[model samples]
Target: MPEPVTLRPRGGMIIAAIALVIAAAALVFIAIDGGLLDLARWAWPVVLLGWGAWLLYLRPYVRVSEGFVEISNLVRTYRVPWGDIDSVDSRFALTIRTRGGRVIRAWAAPAPGARQALSTQRADVTHTPGDDDTRRPSDAEGTASGDAAGLVRRELERHRREGTAAVGQTALTWHPLLIAGTTALAAAAVVSLVLPHG
Candidate 1:
């Protein structure tokens, strides 16, 4: 079997971490400026607890091998076999179509100049179908396809035909949920300040 190929969304972890930091900072600033020391005592804990839970629960979990691809976003895990892939296409997003006619989407960072090279090479291969020496052009193509960038495209295509038997999506990152949570928590802190506390 060829070496296992694994592909993951770029900057996913970095972006998540940055967002968490920003949310935490905003919460801290509100607590200090709003004179809600008591509220901070409670709200900070909640924020910390929520942040910790998110770090533990919302992290990306993805692995790909020669035979299958596995991805987990805490809430759901998807395991797609290699045979079910139909075709892989790269545009603004990397899209994979399965044999069952479903499409899966993920962010892909296609290497600069690589796509043009691959297209040129593919065209060259298509024009010379009669070349019997498999070791020449075929080997080069295989090497390119097996590389990390190539694997991203290949896996997407594979997942389409093999059928994404075990895949799902969820808001595991600090996107809308984290932003909303922080806003609500800040609002609650403000309300707590105005209301008389027994």
Candidate 2:
């Protein structure tokens, strides 16, 4: 069995979240030093925003194992077996189309921005997996979605080449902790804004 490949945490996202957290901590310190809990209340959104940054950017990933592709999106995750996948696409993001016609997008791998797309020339896309005659910017070499889709496509092709008749169903699941935390933090932020903090 080939080793599984995972596109895990994005360093840029992690650094940005850390910066937000630091800013929130500074606000909290000011509130403590001044004995002003009201000021602390104003920091709720900042703290939540820090957590939100991590939730949206750092939490998502795409993992390609010998038998399956796991897509950990923002609030939901999907484990689609090789047998279930019809194709891997990178139109707007890295997406998996199942034999049953369900399409799953991976939030971790998104298309390049307009500037990046404009910079990608025909010379750069020579080795990309899809049709060269008609390729989206998402299929460009340096883009996140393009790279991830390449890995997924290669793995799928290898499965076909090896005659590995893998069998399984596609499973969908929600990120319970993410959902709960976001709800709790959003509520806290709202309360901090409306409730009288003395």
Best by TM-score: 2
lDDT, candidate 2, 74-192, per-residue tens: 79999999989998888788989999999998888988879888888887777887777767777877678888998888778888888783788899998788789889989989988
lDDT per residue as tens, model 1, 15-60: 5666677767767776787667654544644465456445443453
Evaluate residue 124 in candidate 1 and report its C-alpha lDDT on the 0 to 100 scale: 45
Badly placed stretches (over 4 Å) of model 1 are 1-8, 31-62, 71-76, 107-149, 153-198
Candidate 2, residue 131: Cα displacement in angstroms equals 2.4
TM-scores, each model vs. reference: 0.43, 0.87
The lDDT for every candidate, in the order shown, is 0.47, 0.81
The reply for model 2, stretches above 4 Å from the true place, is 8-15, 18-21, 35-40
